[model samples]
Target: MNFSAPSGEVVADRLSDFGIWEAEYRQTLQQFVQEVIQQAETDLEQEPAPSRPTDVDLQALLDDLRAEIAATRFALQQYRQSLSD
Candidate 1:
């Protein structure tokens, strides 16, 4: 027994199924969006403030260069200390 129709009944049923699927799909999308927003907020909460250069601020490209120099100095001092010991 094969039943098929080009009538409004089949169209209505197909549209109802599509409506249900769209609602569920929308809910899933909303959840993912909310999760991303919350994760971003949490990450921002944990992040340190960015050091911006101002008139009073010592922050510069030179600061990073100085840090590297200080690290190398410390390492060299440690090597010299180890050799002396």
Candidate 2:
């Protein structure tokens, strides 16, 4: 009877053939995730801050409200004139 265990070099070569590719794939995936996270963080940092309500905005809203009130009053006057006529 003659039997011998595989040599260390043979086992190492077989492991490298599969293990190297798996390791490369895992490394690539990890790098991709890291890049995506970094990009998201950078985008969040670059985003503009929310604007606070300013005096100009309030003035513009007030002007719009006044215009609407004037228009409504004018329309009511025209409607009343038409009813009288």
Candidate 3:
């Protein structure tokens, strides 16, 4: 007869539904934030990898420096011999 106002049972059911919806919403929001953080970290690591020199590059540089030092030593020896002769 008085259908305008919801019954007590109806109000309680709606409140329960609202609580469940709120909990699900909070969980989903937290999961989304976690995924965003992980993706940002991955991007940052990748950005630096190309800019940082690898072990192979450093080894190559060292080899070139040794070769240059050897060449300089040979040149100095030849110059000393010429001077003495």
Q: Give Cα-based local distance difference scores for all models.
A: 0.93, 0.95, 0.93
Native-vs-model 1 lDDT? 0.93
Instruction: Sort the candidates on TM-score, descending order.
Output: 1, 3, 2
Error of 1 at 59 (Å): 13
By TM-score, who's the top model here? Answer: 1
- Candidate 2 whole-model C-alpha lDDT, 0 to 1: 0.95
TM-score of candidate 3 relative to the true fold? 0.52
Shift in Å, residue 24, candidate 2: 0.4
Winner by lDDT between candidate 2 and candidate 1 = 2
* Model 2: residues with Cα > 4 Å off, grouped in runs: 1-14, 52-85
- Where does candidate 3 clash, by residue pair? none
lDDT tens readout by residue for model 3, 1-85: 6569888999999999999999999999999999999999999987855555445787788999999999999999999999999
lDDT of 2 by residue, 1-84 (tens): 888999999999999988999999999999999999999999989999889765568778899999999999999999999999
On the 0 to 100 scale, the lDDT of residue 79 in model 3 is 100
In candidate 1, stretches whose alpha carbon ends up further than 4 angstroms from where it belongs are: 1-5, 52-85
Against the hidden reference, what TM-scores do the models get? 0.54, 0.44, 0.52
Candidate 3's C-alpha lDDT? 0.93
